[model samples]
Target chain A: MAQEKTYIEDIERTLYDIKNVDKSKYKSQSGLTEDIIRDISARKNDPEWMLEFRLKSLEVYNQLSLPNWGPDLSELNMDEIVTYVQPDAKMTGSWDEVPEDIKDTFDRLGIPEAEQTSLAGVGAQYDSEVVYHSIQEDLVKQGVIYTDMETALHEHEEIVRDHFMKLVPPKDHKFAALHGAVWSGGSFVYVPEGVHVEIPLQSYFRLNAAGAGQFEHTLIIVEKNASLHFIEGCSAPKYNVTNLHAGCVELFVNDGARLRYSTIENWSRNMMNLNTKRAVVGKDGVIEWVSGSFGSHVSMLYPCSVLKGENAKCEFTGVTFASKGQNLDTGASVIHCAPHTSANISTRTISKAGGKATYRSAVKVTKNAPYAKCSVNCESLMLDDISRSDTLPTMDIEGDEADIGHEATIGRISDEAIFYLMSRGISEDEARSMIVRGFVEPIAKELPLEYAVEMNNLVNIELEGTMG
Target chain B: MNKEIFSEIPMRTWNWLGVNEATVDKDLLVESQKLDIDIEADHHEKMVVEYRKESYGIVNISIGENASLKLTQLQLMPEERNHANEVNIVLEKKARLQLVAVETGAKSFASKVNIILKGDKSQADVSVLYFGDGDRSLDMNYVLDFQGRKTVGNLEVYGGLMGESQKIFRGTLDFKQGSKQAKGYEKENVVVLSKGVRNRSVPIMLSGEDDVVGNHAVSSGKINEDKLHYLMSRGLSPAEARKLVLEAAFNPVLELIEDEVLRQEIDSYIKERLENE
Candidate 1:
């Protein structure tokens, strides 16, 4: 029998690669400058304190330098990136009020249908501003605050002011300062004390401008004895010029509360996704993070948790699929600052067609954190010899009572497993696909059924010919 | 005193985490001794080397085709002093190397071991055991660079940290693009004995070849209370039981030492230190 070579096509990306005509109400000039910051502030009608805060963040951004590690980011030029692009539509509560072009984009991405079927509330952003937002009447009557960040600043100024940029300050890193300086639109959710939002609230961000940047600020606070789940979805159309996304997420879980944040980011190949997300848990509180990375040219994202009170807990589960021309560097970090705190992290990464994937993480146990426990496990599968995968994890323990363990492995699909499946009347390509799907089953099951289905579809698109 | 960075991680990360590298302060004018060894084709040899209150600045070893060598090094430093050591090894086709290092005492110690498998079917195995007490600080970097096809590498390190001591351990397993079918594994275990001890571990695996397999694991914690209670039930004092448990942890590498006399000396050294603690 003559052997035949099997070829798997790259991602189709037709659903996410649909570009719209440029009809932005305004576009800030390319590059970072005091003038541009002032212009953005003036256009947004920001409060005086916010303008000052932006200026200070810009100062920090100027003082900071690029990260000395991770993927090569020399190709990113801020001079050619427009810091802000206001969509042609205004923030509205009715989906019919949104511009046809903007609404059509969200329709293609299935945001409205998702909101109508399962989501409790949904906020949709086109380019640099929220075009539409809606919440169920019961949720609103129950005093659950779900709206755009801009509205939160206006109606709930006190709450927004207290927590804005508090967990992730501008000084956290270079990109964080950039996000603080130029952040435009994102979601703000608050679950009141003892209230439980059974259904998940979601926000979808679509960047339709070329050579533009999206700097959204997402803030969620779950009060004492309350529980909530928030999901974030974002993507952009591919362009020749490099697009940037430097968003920031701050989550606060008060005492006896729980919060689960899930995200699936599928940006275009010409994007640089450098986002910062952090959470602080109080006594007996819990925070769960579910993340999936499937796109972007270069990405550096690590969601962090600070266990600040006794008996606090954190759980992180994520998966990354990096194909040709993509370099996704992602992981999780946890700081145990109180006694009896614990954290568990598990992740899977897949690299093929010359792509690169790296898992970087840190776990720190302070002297006060006696009896703290942390465990991290990460696995990587390289589908081709031309690809690269790395695992770098650090653990710093200061007290004898703390227990920490980390395990990592990098390997390719075993020929024996493929052969075993093929002998059972399965094609080689289908067998390979089954193995890859099984590899990510742990993380996929953690997501909602729809998102899990979407992730499976993405995996199939990434391995077209070889996938069932 | 001059200061320099030592035991750098294979891939740098966030500098704020302070795991990328370690800083060592020492006098550059101090001279170090050099040891060189070469094994010819098809030759097998074994040797024991000791460094007592002294430094081995540079050591070079090369193994020819079909050759195998087993080398054991013992480091004993009972006083406050600065020490630094560097070892580099190269292996050709069908070559094998076994290394065992036991370090007991030093006020400030820094060591780096680099091994390169330059030919096909080469293999290397390394085992290390160390103890940190008082104000002592230990920094160690170990690397296995796989450059040939079907190479194998394994590294295991075990240590205890006590008092105000601080230790940083960085172990890397790098499989190059052409190192198809290569297999590498590394693991480190640390036991914190006191409240003031600080332990940092960085286990890295970098692979560019899909056909290769690499793995690393790190575990750090306090002494097992269940085991301690079981030993105490066997008619032993608390301190004695603690020392016995640690000894059991170090026994795997200790049993590999062929020299009974050297092993006895190491045992006595560890016993005295544990008693004082």
Candidate 2:
């Protein structure tokens, strides 16, 4: 079964994996404790309740059991996991103030340049701190609150306290408890009632520290009749030692509001990224999720939605890339709690190498939701025979009037299409890449131009690995 | 070899497949008998499933002198499935058997399914729907043999899988030789509402004899994004819209189950599950 190895699997990208986990100042001691939570809180200058909340969450984190199904998390030892790592820098709204090393990292990622022209706002988090954040002054003057989560917690304490971790609380799952206990830098945005943000606001997270975890928290609230589009980007320099990203993103779309949240995570393979995100849509409100999971050794991310009011709806568009050494179990969940509520989830996955990409999804129509309807269509692309893709979907229809349809197909790029292209003189690799880009292009096309370009570039990079 | 040397084998021999002895449960098998479409004494030249009308004891075997039997109901069933009170019959030429099946259930237990189309020129039109909280595996396999020309068979199954129970559905339309001018169609749809549940749909088609037509198709997933976006953009959250689409998705399968009493029973079971879920 042995053949030639791929380029990305070789040592070419070792620079990204190079790591030095300091044993001194920032290393977390063994096990989770109130003192550890307190020390981290003191370091971050958390208010009284945030500190108390972290300790309360630590209590819950220690008590809850690991998930019974999905990919195994037995390898993730809390004692071995350093939940927090403060990069060597302070928060800076200006690019000049960010430490040279951190700035160079983001520069290589091209975040500052992407923010300069395309995005309306951008927040950059390095390791456990949001080292840089900025937004259009027009947006600032318009009362659209977009800032680093830490500053938001202190300046707009009311908003932070009211909606923090509400959609997915500490007890929702084991990692969520861990996130609530020791969460750090992320983004916070509030789109006011009847307002519309013309451009997408984006946040990029970089896990620059080795043997440490990045626990950022993102909180977004779109008030009644408001509309907003937010994008989140996550990537990390590679580290031989395993790092962890247990970030949490909670969104609340109030009555008549519209919110679309998009995220692209390109972490390194030595990372166990167990992120949790969820949203709640109010009466006549809507929420959309566009997710891309390209890297991470093992990732369990399923963004959920709850239609809590009559006529509420949700749409989840996601694409996952499980290349070598990645077990990405990603999908979505929805609960129709009110009559006539509805949801639709369309997802695509690409599995290469020996990676495993499982589309695990569920939609439940409560008996009280008399007229609920849901339709799911997911497709998977297995680049090679060794890679695996499994589609496990479930629907609980308590309402006779409900409609549910699910269809998924798993195959490689059609040989016919590839041959047809190659016959015209296009190289096989480029032809395959073109087909794959097309396969994932639908989800990419929905993102802002810069993000779409980034997604295509990532897909191209993965395609290069396929050939090498 | 196209030889018919094995007709003497006891009907009981088929039971050797189970862990239990072939004859230990003898009550379900009545007096050994022979049935024939072309007079068993003459048709016995080929490996045959012989039957006698009087063999069912005083059970009264009047399938109507005019009753016509369909021939597609004599094939193999997959392994490891649930069943209760099933009957097998080798039909005489031109006997009829009307078919109706309804599936419904409570938490963890899915609705029961029934299949009975074991005759020549007999039509088995069935519609089954399952709505419940728990996992119920449905493995329904049936075949019909055609002794006369222009025999037809049809089967439709619709069900919902909730909670953690896994559902694997297998439906096949097999057409045999000399059953020329015979045709069959089968379709199965399953809804998986929870990550804990498992759903598998295998729609199979095999034609051993020519001059017969058969086809099968399956569609499974969650909801559609266009539908979700349309609803969400209209001020409805994605979850509410999903419920709407799910109801619309399974409506066709539910509408085919006739029998108001049985339909309502299945409908209520489905509704009850939704409420509890």
Candidate 3:
């Protein structure tokens, strides 16, 4: 039996969809090797220690093995993945100075308009290289340091050297080791004490090179009593071949500081977005993460926070929508390593059209972390019998003095609710979409305005033909 | 995925079987026509499953018209792992069944139940007990479905988890689209052992094309500290006074067990679990 399939015809932001092959273009050899590592070090004009670090990372990457849990990644062979694709242009401050083709691609995606309206600063990376970077002048005068990682190393060497790859070391995992070996062009932000950057600093990653992998590294350090909000967005044009995104982000929140990181990812269907993000918060610090996942054929992501200091806090709010042909396994992790630490996490997910969505969470309260208070709540909606949703939440409580609670629910819409809507003359499709939109209302309300609109639109687009 | 979301998962891989036409295997996608499943439970003097009142993510079990069942269980508390349990039952027109559960607790323990009824006529009653520390939890749920014009059913639970513990209860009554003119009822109660224990009770009802009636109630908490002080005023040691209260609270559930040998085994387990310093 042949049945018609439904897909989003135009994924809204497809302007960055151009593809080309330049054999003579600046590039490195295939696969991960010493030669490839040396080539990357040369391209970045690295110092002596960085070069040695790259080689050491390559050794670790070789010894480590790929993770077997979550989505099966056996079909994604490393040999077929291009580690780096150095764009033709160096890092520039203005969009006009960039090559016309790349500039036009972003221009059509409304990047320039968004930067001008509300963003305090912006950094744009295109396939292993940052093509455009800039920040507001007033903040720079106020001692806020925001610039490319490589440039930061050369200009503010002491600060960059102090925090680079510290929270998450190369030995953390296999992909991390690989990221250390061939990482390129990401942002470095340092917020001064007691200062609050009102407008969010934004970074956008656009993958244009075919069969190439994007391994950008982001490092953010918020000093004592400072506050900052950073926004990140990623997208790629659909391709027949798989493109890999294995970026890394590490945040350090000092005493009494607060940092909120939000992300809206709309990768193309061929993308394998397996990125790592972790934060270490000092005494009395707070870290909040708001995440939305809407694309990719398969994804395995669980952002974690290590509450290291007394009275430190963490909150994670996330939403994931897995449509047909997509298997998205995403959640959050928190570890209370110190006494009086607390963490709260709430996640919502939707599975439709035979797609699979799984929410996995881990909360660990060490023995020394007495009086720790934590709660984890997860909810999933299985649209139909054919669609599947699963929730797996694990709790490890070593201290008897703490209060830890875990709750989860998995169910479908009540037939009576649908029947009532149908009796009111609403079409089945409209009624169903309305219910789902409301189902995800709490999560969408937490997102930025434009992103919230786009999320609802994606929901409508995904529900097309799923109604009976 | 977020700008930061990747945990170090132990690298393991599996050979996935994809679903596609021509090569699609139907054997991998069939629900067994013969639906026969059995579950056996064992506890060191006690086993407990509790739910908070009006809580979500509840596991529900319902009995329909003319349905018959045979159940046997044992409960004991070995002073260490105490469970305070509570459960609710509902019946309607000719829904006939029998359920037996065993319970034991160490310190704090409490139980409560609420039952409702519907259909032409029906009946049900359940019993359970607790022996533990300052442990309290609720086991509350209800099955309220109408029997086809004239049917009946019964439900009973006995068990407890205690030791500064908490329990919950859920009672549900569901009347499907059909089954006009039916009625039934059910009820449950529990005893508390120790302090610092908590329990919640929940009652549920669902009606479609219905002409039925049902009702239930649940209550749980710890032994009043003032009451313990009163026991001290009576010249009994704190441990002996605590044991007296536990024995009185568990008598209802203990009296219902038909086998004396089984009742003695549960009594010994309760004595062991409730042995506090």
lDDT of 1 by residue, A58-127 (tens): 9999999999999999999999999999988889988899999888889998999999899999999999
B37-61: candidate 3 lDDT, tens digit per residue: 2122211111233222211111123
- State how far residue B52 of model 2 sits from its true place (Å): 23
Stretches of candidate 2 off by over 4 Å are A1-27, A419-431, A458-468, B1-156, B159-187, B190-277
DockQ of each: 0.89, 0.05, 0.06
Question: Judged by lDDT, which candidate is best?
Answer: 1
Each candidate's number of clashing pairs is 0, 87, 68
* Top candidate by TM-score: 1
Computed on C-alpha atoms, the DockQ of candidate 3 is 0.06
Cα deviation in Å at residue B56, candidate 1? 5.1
Model 2: chain A TM-score against the true structure:
0.91
Order by DockQ, highest first: 1, 3, 2
TM-score of chain A of 3: 0.93
